[model samples]
Target chain A: MEIQRLSIKSLTITILIVIAGFSVLLSFVSGEYFFKAARESQLYSLNRVIQVATKEIMQQLHDQAYDIATALSIEGEIPKEFVKAVKGETKGELVKALDDPLITGFVGAYIIDLVKVRAYDLKLNFIAESHQGIQGLSPQMPKILYQQGYGRKGVARSKAISGLWQHADKSYYSVLVPIGGIFISGYLEVVVNPVNNLVRLSEKMNSPISIRSGIDPKRFYYEPKKSTEKLLPIEYELKTDLGASAFLLTSYEDIAKLSEGVKETVFNTISVFIGLVLIVLLIAIWLFQLLLFKPVNLMLNEIRNITDGDISRDLQVKGLAEIAILSGEFNKMTKEIRSREEVLTRLSVIDALTKIANRRKFDEVLKNEYLLGCRSGKPLSILMIDIDYFKQFNDTYGHLAGDDCIKKVATALKRSVYRPTDLVARYGGEEFAIILPDTTKSGERVIAEKIMSEIARLNIPHSSSSVDDKITVSIGGYAVVPSIHDDPVFIVAEADKSLYQAKGAGRNQFVLRNEFNSVI
Target chain B: MKKNYLISFIVFLLLVVSGIARAEKPFAPEKLQGTIRVDAEAAAELIVNTPSLLVVDARKEVEYSKGHIQGSVSLLDTEMTLEKLSKHAPDKSTPILFYCNGERCLRSSRAAAKALEWDYKLIYWFRGGWNEWVDKGMPISR
Candidate 1:
């Protein structure tokens, strides 16, 4: 079965595909890792920046609220009114004093979006508030302040405490301060809008900022105005002095746009990398074709021609080391094969024992010559010679000596036919046949006589022969101007009959048969 | 022809016998004794549960500092000495577990063999060591 083969072109293509595929995969993996690391690092820095910005905003708001509370308590009648309202003495007058321009203007100065001011009694009951619709008392207000060591025995004794507080869906930064002079009478609370603070911080940092208030955990505020596809958000929890939770989510300035540049650079680099890889692959393929494939293909063609019985030309050996060596070896192999074929051709037709054309070669030559004679209307002749009493000779002196006698007779017969066109062959045991092209009956007779005389001249000793004291041969000759209808075998049979006649008359004689006459 | 066949048959028989002689016995856990052989899980348990069990990282110090089994002390295979062993683990009878990179590493085995030669009463060889430990998500220390 013939196996499927991969040609050099396809094999190189496959290898190139695998290498290119691996390069693309490697680049994709490394590119993803690089982008991921860049995003993470940007997010980390964004988180730190957001934390610092949030702290600064909270500090500024806390100081402003403290100033407002301290001014109302030290220079105004609001604290005394708060004490009267707490003792239940002239509550309407206390309410009227709380609404005076001095206190109202001071509270109005600090009031803005989502910011509110409230005054609470020592019992933690709410007294007056800048914003309307607030409840009379907020019991949940000062809990974080007390936990952060800001409230002592239900009085604000420490510095102003700032924290995050929630109402419905909105969050506020609340600062609590004591409002009394000598003894603590009430607690003052200032709530400021964290969304405005975060927006200001975002502008100051030149980045996008969003706030996720711990009070209102489900809502986001101060979101930037941009597409967030490439933005890496960094989140940091804001912890005030009172340990309140306010989350700040921010990202680098134009983070989405910045990452686009990174992606573009990476894509460009990968394209160039792939281009370089393809260029290298093409160069490598050209080099291989020049240095290996071209030479190998030429050698292959030469080997095929050698198999087809044409081994005349040697391959041109030129390439790299291995291919050059291969070409050289292939040329050497073809030379060896040609020499061996010549030796085999010679061995096939020559008689191993007699050193003359064997029977098979005689038949081939007779047929070919007969066909040629028919075309040219030329006379072709055959002389069938045999050693007389050869069986008796073999019986008297063993087969080995009989073979030596036959070799001598065959050599004599070969010498008798001197024409270049004539052929002498060992027909069978003790019998020889000669093909004589363009020869007449008279010419055949002369050759027949010469062969008989030549073998008799050898004078090989034959002890048990009645023919002669020396070995001799009988010759029978047949000649014809062969027609297309005539078979060469008929002439061969006629020669054999004449050979029998010559032996019947006497050994060491010649006989001839032509178309019109027969002679002895 | 018959002699040729007889010679060929004798050659084939010799080939078969030689092939059988070259065959090895299958691994049996019972063949490994005199040293307690533990896997990564058992070694991690010994390090965590036994405070006195000296968990030794049998690799170079550079590799040890990169990452190793938690609470393991670096003791390289090439640096194994009686003095160094006594300095870290003075009590000869104290249980000691040695581990290296992984199953393909021979450092831990060599260190364990050396500890045995030192006449230590308890020596544990963690065959599947740091590689298996990290793969299994066990604790690691640098």
Candidate 2:
């Protein structure tokens, strides 16, 4: 399309599409960037929360474990039987301690009173199965809890150990602290199940999460997609409190699930944002078409019509400044054009000097009247008038006076032809022609006599030539009722003959040609 | 040859000195007040008092997140604005400023100076911007 033909709607839509497309692409790219940023930030925050929570919970557990041990140690100091049980000589009390409801929710906590070489089994009795007796499984058997007997192992390992360990053939996080006493060498071990912590943390987050602990060498932790074997990275940290075990605070599955959910949220937000932009673009395009394109087309259409010469219609539009201005301009232009055309038409048909029909107009009227007369079988009449100028009029007066005289005589001739269909023309210099529709030869003669008398009364100077020079004019008249058989040129010839006769008769006279004979 | 070299050297030294002087001049009014480098906070305050101040928000859409100062309008850094300004900015004497992602950004500085060439006076700069306002716990109304 031509550049001018391009409408605002197309331009606006193009612009909006470009803007919206760029916005969408930006949202997609930057949304991903934002999602990654949010994920990183959330992970950092969640890690901190888990660390704090684990430390607080561990502190509470440590104090409780110490209290339980203190209670047992005091009881052992008084009761001989409790003292004997402490030496791996009795298993019932420790078993009773492991089964306590207070320790159920906690990562299993128990004390190995090292004063006795025999270990005390508590909190691990269910998972600890030995072919030997329950007394033998006091905490030393599996190498998962304590490698050697309680006394030897407790003394040999670091005084406080914080690291990952295993139980039930699965890896777990463990925190062990040695408690040196007046009589007994003892240590307290706290094992926290990371799985439970993961479950709790997941509940708080807007996205999904999972936790796992006590895995084997390659510990397979919580998985978001159970079918996927690939393990995404888990950001875990070992946490410790004064009284409780160092625990692993991490939710591998939760992190992955949260990332996925964040990605989805970013996608959804971007989609909605892009959708809103698209809607705005559509509205803009619609408004452009209504307010800009359609009105401009109307202006163009009106302009096209005016150029094609149909100036009758009005351009009707409103509500825009530029369009209103253009419409006003268009109306003004059409009005000017129509008025100018009227002036040109008048200039073409009227005589500038005499203010009467000129030769061109007379010829047009004669042809039209001749056609009408032929169709209606009505008579058509013609008169040819010549001024009886002595040439001496110009010789005596001046060309200006000659012109004045001619104008007066032409006016008289015009007054003589009175019918609506009659036309008088300045045929040439000092000569005039009259068309009389539906007039016969006698009628033509009467008109000629009237014109002759009117010119004679003007009494203009006619002193120096062969004719009486007081500005009289010779008149020739012819009339015929035209027929289908008549030739238009024949009428003019007959008028010419009568004019020759009047001129031949001595300058100032009238001659008429009837259908049968010529009369003068 | 020596005279020509001396002349060339003088021209070169003059060019260098002039360049350095241009660079050192306190961001010329032309560069200071255009849409490319507007001072957002001052522009916002000015807009509230006099709405004619051209307040261009140059923040990347994301940094705009911390929330824009009120009365700061967004003008894409790349969009041509000379024609728009001629039509819209009836008063040449009105103030104009721009702001982007706090102090770490360069978009606002360039935009501010671009508006200055059109003969706008009263150019102001808001260097410590979005981050500072948000960090201070000031209320972002929108």
Candidate 3:
């Protein structure tokens, strides 16, 4: 019954595990949603930042182009000797003016004198127009008497003229204006550097972030099993009206990686917490068993063993209210039983008249020995012994003296065979039997003869002239390996036959039955 | 060495202040100064500054010896008569502080509730009692 109360422990463990499982599941679901929302917000914010910065860059380019146009329009004071050397050529004067501070250190700037274009470097060097500079430029730049965009292909292709070549990387812008009544067209360029922009943007974002200047559709990375076709490619365009087009490509993998870190951390922390909870719970359960359940069971077991007939041992338990109570109850119960058994055992399996094992005890012990012999495949021998002329002896000596004589012979019969396994019983009036387990036929005969002789040695006189001059016994013994099919009654009948034969031949002797074939 | 010294000083201060202001109500001494080593002392100092107060003593007859503050009464031997105190200590809102012998003393603290049962509000316990009061000689009367 106390064991039934232990269901509470299992119930508590189940409830805790269920709570933990649900919490982990909820955390995973919420974490997934959080990762999705954070990644999208990060991307949107990065795009906005790039758009704003690029707009500023475009505005600066447009302003520089206007200044170059203004510079080309002005006429510098050329000395007569300088004019003679320049031959009044606009190209020479424009090239000489390229060293001006306005043109120097600028990202993209170009000056055109009639047909020729000169671009200024950060070092203030003026270089003649190369083939590439003449072709590529910002598409937003205005055309002036130049057939560049006038051909009307794609507007971007026609307006593009790359002229301002710097740092071995060319990024160009185009401008057209009138210089001294002559239409001059110039192309300015810059090389787009997204690395610095991306680094700075990442710092501002204060999270994992990236930016790419040129878009390539192939740059997307995805895992096949987790990615579906529904997850479309991310594409955004960067357009400066000056005919520059830069595609923006970003990977969702970066977001995925960040989410993985979070997932791993969360799972690791949960696993550790779960492990700790399990360990603590295990210790609690063990303590409950040790201090509570185990001691209680021990008291119960001691009680069980005492009730089962071992009354010597007592229960010893300490600690815990319930267990202590149980221990006390058990000790009291076993003590009562031991004292009661002291009285009851004397009356158990003992004949009041003969002081030998009674018929009931013989039946119980015979069945037990027979069952044991059947199980163990051992031979058991039984002897059915009857005193000859017992009725006449009772008639002469009176019932009391006859009862006394039977008891005297029964005592002698019991004392003759003294093995612990041997059992002697007063089967009925004047009929006593001995059950010898693990004995062969010859061994049974030898024991039966000894018991017969010991009874004769008691030397009680019998005047009845049927078998012998003195009181005597006729013993019949049968030995067999007991089995399921063999009846104990059949063995007793066979021994009884031998007993009749002994009485017919002469009393005070034992008759042995030879081995017979088993019916089983 | 400086760090260890600072730590030791802090521990010492905490122990000393812990001995005093062991009361629930603010402990406003007749005169007050110095930093508190314990949070409870600081809390008591904050509330006990005003006048018009009731102080209950729950110490035994032998313990009431040595010293006790003026205007304080021993309620330990008195039968539970919360209803009779309405006339002598009329204001239910007046601050009250209760104190007994030492750390093991729960008697005075329990007695403080008698005033509360009578609906005398603002009850407190001075956990330190006479031993701490004599250590710091602010003000005293037999």
Candidate 4:
């Protein structure tokens, strides 16, 4: 491609724009992604809080039930009677033992949320409960435990086999424990209202909580029907040994905190994105300027200078390797152009055939001599020489011979002028002019006569010549000391008039003229 | 290159550890052998009166942890070795009681039988096991 086709300035701008676009896109996409992630993670953590709280509440119930069971087992009277009952003793005594005020009172003192303490037989059949004669819960065992086995939980496992049984709006946390320790006469079901402890659960969490029937809504706003304060709801399931979702423990988290956290997260994400983008943009621009744009612009200016005819200076740029190389190449190109121009200048001042100065150089030197003569009050002279009957010689001999004869005559005329300050030029075809600086009138005549003798000595045959059977030339000379108002062309005109007179006298002759002399 | 070495070293350590573990264990019998199998109440009476009796729970640790009799140290029948048995009851004549999940489970029987082969004396096999213990509502702890 041409050098100007891919301008570095335009390329830099394009690359900068592309980088900016990519950075903006990255920032925007990441901002969106992080915003969603922040919100989702916060909501997820709230759900986690709900899960841990429910587990803790369930764990507390199990621990309390286990402690109560251990206490009852330690009470000798209760276990002793239970053992007898398990050994197939009559149920009347066991009923009496369970209904006793002392036994019931002892259980009541252990827990505050205690709903009831009921006993199940080996077949998990309901027997006698506390003397309060509470009318609740079916007399039959929970079918899940009964159908699985005859209270195998009382023997097989020891985690206080529990289930959450919801009756109306009141949900009870019930634990099934083997009451008589190792012998396990029957299972004791301790039913406690988990809602009362939930008050503490809410207080412990520093949030409000509500128990729904089933855990379906995991992420939702708290019931607007309950309170006016804006709140986010986090929910968890309280599962039972029956492996059923018993209740939804929904904790109302103040939206103010969640929103503040989300806002901070989102703000930080966007700020970081913007910061990264800005840093990237700055770095990219700096690199472009340092490595590409600055150097290219410098090169362009240098090239402009070259185009404006100032090819002397070289392009030097300190930058990236490629840009340095490009500048070096540009400098090399300018050097080539300067050298070629020098060659063209030299060729323009030279005559092609004679290997001497041409007419243009002659006039230029004559004018300069005239000016110098005017300044120094010195004399300047010009000689106009011509070959006599050179056309007849060309008709007789051939054009090649004519050219050879002209070359010889011009060489003789040039050799006769030995002054370093003199200039011999091929004024036109077969005509020559010599410019002499600091030459007086006699000196001019001497140089014109010497040129005639040099041509004669060459002895070049010219049978068609009217003067002699050899090549010869007519010489005309003029000398003048130029003044400030004098034109160099006056010297040229005087020399031409004298040359016409000499050619009129006959060929192979010389004539000299000067403004101060009578030969003019 | 560093990662490769770490992985190889881990694999080598695993191989060496497993090799030593395999080499260290003694053979245990799979089937039940001769032992005096007592009921749960009788076993409880023996344990209550005899402070010298060592109660061995012959169930997997997970099953045992669900709840075993109080003061019973757990060792699965499948994992039993002569060294392990001796560690529990150093005196061959010491009264050693073994129990597992009740009659449906064979861990106690196999353990008791393994003990008999090891020439241990006074091995009481509580065949009714933890099932009968809890079923009878006998005194128990976690």
Interface RMSD list for the candidates: 25.1, 29.1, 45.2, 7.1
Tell me the tens digit of each residue's lDDT in model 4 across B1-142: 9999999999999999999987655333343455667777677667656778989999889877666776789999999999987887889988989988877677787788788888987888887788788666455665
Ordering by lDDT? 4, 1, 2, 3
Error of model 3, residue A103, in angstroms: 99
Q: What lDDT tens digits, residue by residue, belong to model 1 across residues A404-493?
A: 998988889888988888999999999999999999988988898788778878889998889788898888888988888978999999
Per-model lDDT: 0.74, 0.60, 0.57, 0.74
- TM-score: which is higher, 1 or 2? 2
Complex DockQ per candidate = 0.01, 0.01, 0.00, 0.11
Q: Where does candidate 1 clash, by residue pair?
A: none
Residue-level lDDT of model 4, residues A21-98, one tens digit each, is: 787787768767876787788889888877777678677766676666555553555566666766778766666655
What candidate 1 gets wrong by more than 4 Å, as runs, is A1-32, A48-204, A208-253, A269-352, A441-446, A518-520, B1-142
What fraction of the native alpha-carbon contacts across the interface, defined at 8 angstroms, is recovered by model 3? 0.00
DockQ winner between 2 and 4, please give it: 4
The estimated TM-scores of all candidates read: 0.47, 0.50, 0.32, 0.69
lDDT of 2 at A46: 68
Q: Categorize the docking of model 3.
A: incorrect
lDDT of 1 by residue, B113-138 (tens): 88988999999888777887766534
Candidate 4 wrong stretches, greater than 4 Å: A1-29, A70-93, A101-104, A107-109, A131-133, A151-162, A166-189, A197-200, A203-206, A215-228, A254-262, A265-355, A449-453, A500-506, A518-520, B1-142
